[model samples]
Structure formats: structure tokens, C-alpha cells
Target: MARKPTSPADEVLLAAARARSSTVTATQLERWRGAGLLPRNVTRSLGRGRGSTSAPADGVVDLVVWLAQHARPGRRPHDLALHAFGEGLAVPEPTVRAAWRASVQRVVLSGERDLPAPADGEDRTDWAWDVAERAAANAASVVLPRRMRRIDERLAAAGVSWAPSELTQYDRGPAGEEPVTARDFATFAAAGVLAGAPELTGPAMAPHVRALLPVGAVSPVASWLEYPDEPGRDPAEINDGAGLSLLPIGDVREDLLRVIDEAEPHQLRAAWRAAAEMREWALEHCGAVEAELDAGELGDATLAWMMGAILGLPRLLVRQALLDRRPSISTQVSTAVMVLWIGVSLHRLRRLMPDGQYELLPALLPPFLHPLAGIPLKPVGEAAADDAVG
Candidate 1:
């Protein structure tokens, strides 16, 4: 049977979907469009007083057909955007923006823009401590999440205890001098800045470079940031070598919201790719560590993984989320934004160096991060091959 010339666009899409063996319906199409997951159709007028003809826009039929085929019962519009963007499909721009924005909205920071000045006859140092205490209130608590503690228990059961080393203090952290960790310092620094205290920047720098690069490389790279020295440090020495530009100069949260909201389609797609890559690398690296532990072997892998326990991906994810269910794509996208921010900041630090010939830095990292750093990770395969040779 021939269809009418002016059939509704949704019906046309449905027909295309049916051809592809998809279970799409008019209602589903309407809902997807409302959620910004699907693009709207185009309408054109016929000549000589004829009625108008409406049809799905270019690539719409194919996308709709895909949506019909792959749609999960509880899958969200943001998830669809992430999948579509990942697959190189032309997802609607608004959908990508809104979904990414929503992803970052989950993280919350509480503080006032202006802190009350020290009262008359108040000790200035006491006032600073009071302010710092309030800022530290939100710092990541020392009590490990249940999942992380379970992993720690497993490591302990295996007689795998980390030596108290300067390179990786996370195993027995909260170093005696300051209760402020890199993260707590960050919170205080941010609040202090907003409250008109730029001096906090020197001490508040986050050691994100160490997470991205090895300690040896991190030292030189940190110097490249041109970070101002703290009181006890030499002027040439950047306090912990973390640069101040990792985040923009305004409200960090608001800046992130704007960045996601205003990002172009290609930009969003790039972040999606990074997000997917980050997840893959994390899973692969963590799985490799677990495999080694199960096989009763101890080596560099365990050392690196344990050192990164708190600063790396959430323990809830490694021990719980994967077993429970996958994270929503929107959340993955949000995480990617943060990763990129660190990466770009690292690159910016490098650009500050006088002689930038350290291209081998990625290859120099701990084995776990090698894959993500673009070093082709094949230690497992190599080990198997070595056994064969032996």
C-alpha cells in the first residue's frame, strides 16, 4: 500500500524504523524530541495552494531507527545522547549541553562569597583558623567508604602493606604538619579567594600533576607552572609545584556549568570520547591489579594501585557500582570534563617550560596509568610470552 504524500514526520520515521526491525512508536518519538534526544522535522510548502509536506530532517530516520532498536526500558535521554555521540551520530546540540550540565550539577560546594572580617580585638591567627575549619568541614572524610575499606582489608589479608614513603603517602595519610589535604586545601583556597585572600593560592594548589604524571616528571613540570613559592619554600620553587590555573578564575562550579552548557557539539563529542577512554583505562588497569592479586603475585601494579586508592576513581565504583550496575552516561561525561581540565592544565604547565623535550613522560609513568597516558599497555601479554620463552 502506498503512503500519503504528506504523512506526519513521526510516522515516516516509524516506517523507516520498522524497515530496520525497530520497535519505535509515535509516542516514543515525541518523548525523545521533547527530551532533546531527537531532532525535530522540517516542513515545506507545496506550490499552487497545495498543502504543506512535513518530513524528518536529514539523518533523522536513521537515528530514530537506531533509537528504536537500542532503547532500553529505563535508559535516559542523557544516556542516549552519550551513546549517540560516542557512535559518531549527530545528536542534537541542546541535548548534549543539557545532559552534561545535569551531570555536573550533582556535585555541590557550600560557602559564602564573603567571610565576615575579624571582629575588634580578635586574634588574626585565630580568625584564620576558624575560617579554615569551616572550609575543611566539607573535605573528603578520612573514614574510607565501605568499598574502599574492603579493598584495604583484602590487601591487608594478603600481607600487602605499603611502606610509609614520601612518593605515595595516601596509604597512611593526613601528614602530621597540616590536617589540610590537597583537596581540603583546595576548598579553603577557593573560599579564601572569594573572600579576597589571594595569598591562599600558594598553599592551596592541588597536586593533580602527580596523579597525571610520575613524581620525577611531576617535580620539573610543577616548576613549569610558575607557581609562586610559599613562605618556607624558595622563590623558584612552586609550593608542591601545582599551578593555579587548573581551574578558571571565577566560581569553579559556575565556570564548569558554563563550559558544559556552551560547549560545541564537536567539543561535547571529544569529551565523550575522553570519558569512554577514561572508563576503559580504569577498568582495564583495576582488573589487571585484581588479576595479579588473585594469582598471588606482588609487584609494581599493586604498589601503584594502592597508592592511588583515594585520589583515583571512587571506591564505590570499583567495589560496588560495577557489581550493582553501570553508571549513567551523563555522569561519565561529567567525569571526563574534570579529566580534561587536569590534562589541559598539565599541558599548559609544560608550555611554560624553557626546554620542552620531555616527550617520553607518558612512557615513564607507573604501569597502571601507562595505558591512559597513550603508552600501549601490553605487560600481561608480554609476561605470558616471557613464560613461553622461559
Candidate 2:
């Protein structure tokens, strides 16, 4: 039998759902709704005993599409909820955090039970669990505050205003462009961002690196040199030496190139692991901040911390993972990739500000030893003195 033709209302609803991305499907939508990552559709009565039809809630389709892009098997539901919140969904903050906390408790309990019987002279399994518990507790206590503080310091130094409303809407640059570089990664690691194993790399390094480049700009050199076009500029005309030099990652190109040239197969695997972990952590942190913002509890202090986390955490994780141990071929390559990832993310955040805002806020500049290397160097002491006199 032939199926009945769809109504115009149904067609409009389907089109609205697909506006963000063309790949959404009924199964994915249902799954997300079941998981509570999306809201239920609104239905109208058809009269008699006939079934009702509904349209997907406003923004729910976009939210579902975004969540699908980041979904992985074995990922916890709370984590998904948090991710949705971080991506600016209207999900309630308390609900997501409550879910996350409960999930964490379950994992902790399962981890305790799953411990294998220790061999002779191996009483450290229990000790390891204890340490893990303590670390989890510490992370819970400090992660949010620490992130907010870091952001605050950076913004203060940069002289950016801290109104919560403005901060929430603060641009993170072009959606596709994220700055990643080796030098920033090295610096972040030295500063102890995520503080994990020297031997292990985050899992998402390769994908992150690939995401930073334009299509066909996959070669190491091309990815490093190519700049995404700025508003009002031609893409082909945007890569002048001076413009390139102005980027923090630009200074680290040689270092990043060398690391990529020397990576071994096993080391690459480790790098991949490290990169994935860093990206995950970043998204998780972003979600937490966004949740708090939604709750109307994001004070200046907290907002600052979040800004810091966004700016610093990726580099910290990547750098520490790469430099924690002796440099091997895999670690080197992983480090190079991770650096690019961090650099790209950082560049994107910097670009999020209106063009002149970045320049006006000096603290937003990359943390370079010779900060003036790319941009014209101004004497801070003179500027301060002038301000004092004024």
C-alpha cells in the first residue's frame, strides 16, 4: 500500500530540524529524547481516536545534531547532558550536575569492585583506588573555581570587562577555526594544566589536528602556514608574512614541524590517546561553566575562572602529556599534533573578540617571551606611567 503524503506542517517541522545539519535522523532524535538530552515534541490532537503528530521543539534539532557530532559509545549519559549544556542548550544546570555526580559515584563504586586480585608483593591496587578517590574529590572541589580564577586573571590582565551578560555572549571566533601550536602546548604543559601521565597521550589528537586545517591543507607545512580569512579579507591574500608572524603558533612552527617529522608509530598511538583526553576534559569543563552560567550563578570570579580554563587547560594537558617523559618518536609527533590543537583553539578564542578588542586588551596576547616579536612592541612601563599621570 502507498503511504499517505506528509502534511505541510510536518514538512516544515522536518526542515526546521535539519537546518543546522543535513544528517539528523528519526532514530537519533528519539534516542536523544529518551536520554533526556533533548525535550519531547509538542503534539496536536487529530480528534477521534487517531494518533497525534508533533514537531520537534525549537532548538532541539540543533542540539541533537551537535550532540550527535560529539557522541561516542560507552560515554556516560551525564557527560552527554553536560556536553549539551556546555554547547549552550537550555538544559537546567542542577539537573545535569546532579546526573554527572551520580554517574561518577557509580563509576567509583564499580571501579572498586572491578579491581583484580593482587599478585604477591602487589598490594598497590587498593592504594591506587584510594589515590583515585582522593584525586576525584580534589578535582570536584577545585576544578570549577580554578578554571574561573584563571579566566579572571587573563581578562583582568587584558583589561577586558567582566559583565556576566557580555561574557556569556563573548565570541569564540569563527566556528571552524581553532588555533593550535607547539610552543603554547609546551608552555601549558610546563605550567601543569591537566597533570597526567607523561607516557600517555590524549585520545583525540589526530582528529583535533585535522579539524584545525582547511580542506586540502592537510600537509604539515600547509596547515601551519594557512590562515583562515578574516572578515573583509580575501582568503588568498590573508597569509602575508607579517600577518602570519602575528599568530602565537607561528613562532612555534619550526618546533612543531620537527616533532611531526620524527614521530614513531607506537608514540603516535600514545599521542592520540593524550589528545582525545584533553579534548574531552575541555568539553567537560566548558559544560560545567555553561551550566553555572545558565543558573545565573556565574559571578565575575567564576566567569574569570571559566575563561582561564577555556584558554589554558588544553595546552596544560597536551604539554604535560608530551613532556612528562623522555621524548620518543610517538610522543614527539603527538606533542606536535597536540600543540597544533591547543594553538588552534587558542587562536579561535582570541579571534572571538571584536577585532580591536584583542589589541586593546594586551593581556590577550600569546604568552611569548618576546611578546612583541610579531606585533609591534610597546613599552608597558611607559603606558602604565602615562595612565598613572592621566
How high is each candidate's TM-score?
A: 0.58, 0.27
Error of 1 at 15 (Å): 1.3
Instruction: Report the C-alpha lDDT of model 2 over 35-112, residue by residue, as the tens digit.
Output: 776676667888898978777567665666676577678876666765565445654344453543343233332223
lDDT of each: 0.54, 0.42
Tens digit per residue, CA lDDT, model 1, 55-139? 8888887788778777778888788887886787767877767767777775433423245545642343344445556666766
Identify the leading candidate in terms of lDDT.
1
Candidate 2 global TM-score: 0.27
Local error of candidate 1 at residue 49 (angstroms): 14
Model 1 quality (TM-score)? 0.58
lDDT minimum window of 10 residues, candidate 1: 209-218
lDDT of 1 at 168: 42
lDDT of predicted model 1: 0.54
